[model samples]
Target: MQGPARAVQPDEVLKDPQLETRARDLSKDLRCLVCQNQSIDDSDADLARDLRVLLRQRLVAGDSDAQAKQYLVDRYGDYVLLKPPFKTTTLVLWLGPLVLLLCGIWVAVGFYRRRGAAQGETEASIPLNEAEQKRLSKLLANERKR
Candidate 1:
């Protein structure tokens, strides 16, 4: 047998399919105030249910989705939007990935350039000193033995 959720969910049959569609779209884009990581559409929290009802009421009262969302944003700030508008205030959030990507590319290029420059440097023309010659001879002997 199914659980209690299977009953209450079906009981709230949306009278208008268009309203239901709009509600789905709006809820999916709205972050749940209680469960900050979840959208209202995906949250079972009481606050999520309340927000759903509020959105439906606003829609029925002829408020477009944008207006309803703006109302919520005005009340709760941009955190209410799961995907907020890319404006001056949120420019860091919008451009952060690209900025990080460019930095990574620049660092990689710098590393490669440094590596090439280091490789281009000439090896010492002089022979190894006494201690260095002993170490090198031991190392060569070990390698040959291996």
Candidate 2:
């Protein structure tokens, strides 16, 4: 016996070639949330199966390829799409890495500045006044004569 209800085969889709192609293309780009890395077409999870059925129903109902995909997005949010659109809603998802990079640079700059300041302090020396220099030289000369 068959392992389970198998997918509608590509060969069997010859009756409606355009619909089959559209369904395939859309399913491949859509994600299976139940199986994170797997596309809707590839995953046999319940959610993926539901999406597959939904795709076929929409195709048969005369929704254009884009329209059907958009319909799913409307129901599930852009998270349903493999590559979610970049929008204000998704800005954090898209720009998270860049924000982290900028923060790291800011921290590094501050750390470097503080380290430099510490080094300057550690190596700092005060210059003597003219009177102090003269007194030091005279003391040295007196010691030498002794």
Q: Rate the local accuracy (lDDT) of all candidates.
A: 0.79, 0.81
- Candidate 2 has an lDDT of 0.81
Candidate 1 Cα outliers beyond 4 Å, as residue runs: 1-13, 33-38, 44-47, 122-146
Give lDDT tens digits, candidate 1, residues 76-107: 88888999889998888799999999999999
Top-lDDT structure, candidate number: 2
* RMSD of candidates 1 onward, in order: 6.4, 9.2
In angstroms, the error of model 2 at 113 is 7.5
Worst 10 residues of 1 by lDDT: 1-10
Superposed model 2: Cα runs more than 4 Å off: 1-15, 105-146
Per-model TM-score versus the true fold? 0.61, 0.62
lDDT (0-100) at residue 78 of candidate 2? Answer: 90
In angstroms, how far off is 26's CA in candidate 1? 1.5
TM-score of model 2 vs. true structure: 0.62
